[model samples]
Target: MSEMVSHSYPRVALIGECMIELQQHANGTLKQSFGGDTLNTAVYLSRLLGSAAQVDYVTALGDDSFSDAMCQVWTDEGIGLSRVQRLPGRLPGLYCIQTDASGERRFLYWRNEAAVRECFTTPAAEPVLAALPDYDVLYFSGITLAVLGETGRARLLSTLGDARDRGARVVFDNNYRPRLWRSVEQARQAYRAVMHEVDLALLTEEDEQALFDYSDGEQILQTYRAMGVSEVVVKRGAQSCLVSVDDRRYEVPAHTVQKVIDTTAAGDSFSAAYLARRLRGGSPKDAADAGHQLASLVIQHPGALIPRSVMPV
Candidate 1:
């Protein structure tokens, strides 16, 4: 649980919302695509950090044609759409998914007036929240604070406290939905207001037992190391994947899928190969074994992406 140097390229960004999917099937056909959970972890962290890193995805889209094929599939998966935004008569936001017989899934949304709920509250989001504090990693989730309501989550918590006061490295991904919040104490006060500008959380022990009901996984890793979050990571889908990292703890193990068929972006491709193997330096148990070997090859494939030549080398 050490090695995390990272910075030969690192620029990442990933805010949220990128809907327009459909899926359905069971003989009642459908299947269009383009997912969300932080755009499926920004298309698997731009196909696992292809040029070392510079992911970029922010959000807000419209000028239809499914927002120009979701910006030509994030510009053919190299991501970096210079912080996308498009608004005008707005659109982007829709869902469907259905999957039964074990691959478990069931959404249905239509996104309350999407266009990323005014992505950071327009005025062209004040230069995309002032160039997102010059990113070096700044992911987003908990369904991006339940679709950035309260004025785009107070301008994304003041651009995540000025991108962690310049040292950047926010990263968080609880993913909880609870019918897009309005209670559960307003999603635990918007997840304790960004858990003190989180520095790598990636949680999901059933979304910390349905948002802070804490059914002890060491009390959700000592409540995200008592809210200072110095690398937490819980995951736990098909068992083992703990990794605390600052007071050291580990767990790992999870890759025995004989068949899954589609658990829709299994934890967004295991938080994109555990943040592309911890931004390439690897070692939080080798980035949770490259996030359980790319979420056991993305739930044996179906949607939420999986086919950049069946990656994983």
Candidate 2:
């Protein structure tokens, strides 16, 4: 209800792995970049907010060449790296995105050995965990939890509880990866526990359906609301996205794009812009529109991150 730009921007942290992304084109050439759901969101959120907000990435990467390149990209994008850790000999995950003529994407992952798996359990993680409560906003995803293993997930959940108690808004993006878990029941338990601490939730309708077998998006909305989430957003790809806060619900359509080169990070960027707008005091509807606009443009490009020169201001 207040003007977003009127107040000082808040600090936001996004936690997840930044994997080595390989995109293969029809011409047999491969494009290289670093991407992960939360990292992608952090980059776009930083780009959208600029100096208005402080954006930091929270993850662990290897001290290898690929990880070095990844950090360089993040630094150049103006993303803070204070919370990012480097483990010796451990490497980041690798994933390749293959798209068909219809712009549909298929992912092949090799992330079982990523350094982020121990991100929350390392002796060095104590300080990071303690400092989390100081952030204005803490953002993470299903993948963030899954990659951490059970002990790490428990630690993270504890931090989320503590952070929420400190008046920091905990935002969750349900980027569920079925293969990451041993079984559906295990994932449901983990997500349900963390869901209780989430103030803002960005959920993809499809992922919810896949993970929880929700009859529809409306059921998913009701489920999150029952779990005490203050605001729940449902993203339906090229379709409309729904937002609900308490008893009120708003339906907003996604931007219609004539072309979609790759869908890599569309939801991730959308979440970033939405949170950035909300942190700056923009209304929920305005934030959703900003999200859709950014995602539409992102899909028109080839990778999770577009060139900074072409980024939205």
Candidate 3:
């Protein structure tokens, strides 16, 4: 691993969906854009890594206007699209975000038929999975698992085992939304089944308590360690993030901002920079620092994918 592109660099792939997001304006208008957890991470990581790392997105989408815009956006951000699949008849998901006067946002989803839902189980995914093991790092999230459904989930689990066996490091972020699953127990089992294969786990303390009902942050870290994740980051909004790597723990303080326009993707961006830095051979503390630096700016933005100009250069 090398921090500089002139040296060696790693190829990292983020697997998930990108949806057409509508942020309703105060005047009853919709500000349309694209975003999702792993997509946000992919964009942020590409910005953070620049040419030093090869950041690609692995997912399936329909041949529609929204999907076209997404592909263009990824290309503009320098994300490789060699693994993206465009399936016929199927389409990307859409979500609307409505905010109150105080800037609290509410979401409504329409993703039951999204193409990425069957991305893993389709014949097209075979080549993608085969190529995945060659990458240095593979990233996915809880939403990805939930959306993949039963058959896709089973296929993904097997692919992950093969990827891990082939030396590809797996990274997971626990972004738990109750609406995505039928029951908490179902999500818990899915998370536990995949946790052992993860090399790094980016967790939000609040989400952990919601999903697994951990007693404390210590329990969260201990539990992830038991799951065989050597590196675990516990994030709490506006507070310090606790990172456990190897046998050492570091309390990395987050930057304070005057206000948070929207807290969306704060953890996603943090995970991207943290993994990007770590993949570049930067120290764990340095990676944590980079994570916080990127996340601080993200919290100040109005959406999940912020203006690229504001991103760290």
Candidate 2 local lDDT, 72-177, one digit each (tens): 9899889999999899999999998887887677889999998999899899898899988888889999999899999999998999999878778889999999
In each prediction, how many residue pairs overlap at the backbone (N, C-alpha, C within less than 3 A)? 1, 1, 0
Q: What is the C-alpha RMSD of each candidate to the true structure, in Å?
A: 17.8, 2.2, 2.1
TM-score of each: 0.35, 0.94, 0.96
Clashes of 2: 1
Q: What is the per-residue lDDT of model 1 for residues 157-253, given as tens digits with 9 covering 90 to 100? A: 8789987788788888888888899788898888888889888888888877977788867789887888888889898888888888888888989
lDDT-wise, the better of 1 and 2 is: 2
Top lDDT hit: 2
Q: What lDDT score is found at residue 86 in candidate 2?
A: 92
Clashing pairs in 1: 141-144
Error of 1 at 29 (Å): 4.9
In candidate 3, which residue pairs get closer than 3 Å at backbone N, Cα or C atoms, i.e. clash? none
* Cα distance off (Å), candidate 3, residue 127: 1.1
lDDT of 3 at 199: 84
